[model samples]
Target: MIFSRERPFLLVGAGKMGGAMLSGWMAQGIDAAAIVVQDPAPSPEMAALLSRHGIRHVTEVPQGLTAGVVLLAIKPQLMDVVLPGLKPAVGDETLVLSVAAGTPVARFEAAFGPVPIVRAMPNTPAMVGRGITALFPTTRVSAAQRDTVDRLLSAIGTVEWLDSEAQIDLVTAVSGSGPAYVFLLAECLAEAGRKAGLPADLAARLAEATVSGAGELMHRSSEPPATLRRNVTSPNGTTAAALTVLMAEDGLQPLMDAAVAAAARRARELAG
Candidate 1:
């Protein structure tokens, strides 16, 4: 068991990300009885899940209880208001795990003192058990606590530890917002195919399948992506022609660089 049953886990929100993590934890065999959810207005789907599992759901943080782990899954905007009330749940031994982006460790320290806090950003693919999450642990975090946090997070997907919190903004721009970029590519590819005379529906299906298949192939391959691209590109072939345009001086790389920079800047703004 990743968590100790002595003190219950207090989940501060039950939105999509929080609910996804909750579902992942339950599916991994964490005791449902050891979990308590605090969300004023959870979706019907999430409410149904809490009911089915018999996990405690509360609109407010209950008094007179010390949580073993307090997972902060609320929005960054709500941190200032909501955190002040969670003091009762955080004991000295508790590990605070946050999945809220743009909210740093200092903000948490302001709320609950110098307790062990880990701030993380997880991509949406975590719901399907294929996500990648980047975490930044404060100096206060113990080695054993880090291991526990790793185990809990690994329930949903890959967990990577960061050396500095500033890198979080860069990560937010890349993998944190990366899935949307891939989806956009698929959309553009389908439109291009339709414009080139393929049936609209067929083009959409082909684009979706190709994107997903390529992603899976990349996932399974040991070689770097460049090697895979080389293997796919035959001399003077259709793919090679397309790559020529995409790899040009003013091509995909520059566009992606600008997009990521913009996202990172926004992340920093949100943090402040």
Candidate 2:
């Protein structure tokens, strides 16, 4: 309801995340005609989707038009060049929703001159519509525009709104980069199993299944992760033994704390 079919939804990129969002919008019954995508070289799959939806796809920005929502889904490095071309299409009423990581709201205002902006950090899982995004909106954003952003992002996954833009960098580290960390955990788990004498293929499968199942349980359960861990551990049992090493003084906790901090530091650096 927040999104308007009357006004054009100008999308600057049709890459993975952008394409995923479009897929969601279509599935939710958005009129394909209302969307216009601009990408120099879209993937075959993306091209097919656009064709199927009958959405306009252009390699260049059309001259002198007002877009209701200018969604920027391109790389942050390209913003310097891309924003200039897009500026003409951004009217005072345009709500700019950027999904580019490490890009701040001021960057857009500096280019487009104080249009309503919402900066978001979304992870790779958005391809599967299971991603979690963190959003930071400028003070200029109206309540109705915020609702529009909420509905638009809901297409990808759950959304968390932050009170301050500075918090977005932390979010960039957490949910935005968190999926790779989980994948790395699965890799290490598989390696550990292989080292413990299981066959390589079997070890990988076991590790993958365990991680995925545990993640599902965490999602389904109302209890905290710590409680879930304790629930699985018995006196001097295998799970407890593993937890003893994992929960040691110099263990997973300290390591993970350092990892998250390092990621946050890098996020701030990228923003700069």
Candidate 3:
């Protein structure tokens, strides 16, 4: 069964990421009344949103209400505080889906006591419904439970499953922290254009447009990135000149390798 149709689900934290997921669910025609949002202090945006949609809003967990699914959207640091209180509300049948970065499946299982747990890493782009999420489900999770999590996550963006728990950290480093890397590329490109004598405003505009357009192209085209690069690179043209520098011995390969590695290391540290 698609989880979107499941009624009376509980969102344990209505922060930015949680709110975004709520918005996506509502956009996809999920009944707002089926959701119960709990936050100590809901943002003005979240409050107004829930009110407008007629969804139940609570400053704390409601008594005598059992949710079909419990979304643990709270920060990782607050898990101990939140999970203990949440145990009562989470029935044995309830599937727990967590979007908290660095929180492991074992931790959730320990707290919730052998419940079906799914740990997901979703990037900031999820706010715009263009994100990619990596999901890792505990061994106890049923195929139906996994599908339910996938359906809910897919409402916001694309979803992929990882076989190994260790891959979750790599996924966090890649797609989770990947947006910042792309933004940094835009920053570098704009600054390089300004240094090469373009006006600041024009340089920024060009850099933004170029990056956005290239991304759109990749999304629409069937060709691989290497093929796309070769398509625009003439035998002795400006594109080729730039490629020579970027693909050289001291260029992108080593830089990106180090950057991803650092992010993966940081993810491991966060897990601890």
For all candidates, what are the clash counts?
0, 0, 0
TM-score of each: 0.96, 0.96, 0.94
Candidate 3 vs. true structure, TM-score? 0.94
Winner on lDDT between 1 and 2 is: 1
Show model 2 residue runs off by greater than 4 Å: 1-6
Task: Kindly report the root-mean-square deviation of model 2 from the true structure over all alpha carbons.
Answer: 1.4
RMSD to truth, every model: 1.3, 1.4, 1.8
Q: How displaced is residue 197 in candidate 3, in Å?
A: 1.7
Ranking by lDDT: 1, 2, 3
Tens digit per residue, CA lDDT, model 1, 1-272: 33555688889999988988888888998889888899999999999999999989999887787888899998889988888889988988788998887887888888888899988899888898888899999988888888888887899999999999999999999999999999999999999999999999999999999999999999999989999999999999999999999999999999999999999999999889
Instruction: Give the Å shift of residue 113 in candidate 1.
Output: 0.8
Candidate 2 local lDDT, residue 271: 77
| Ranking of models by TM-score | 1, 2, 3
Report the lDDT tens digits of candidate 2 across residue range 223-266: 99989988999999999999899999999989888888998898
- Quantify all predictions' global Cα lDDT against the true fold: 0.90, 0.87, 0.85
Number of the top lDDT candidate: 1
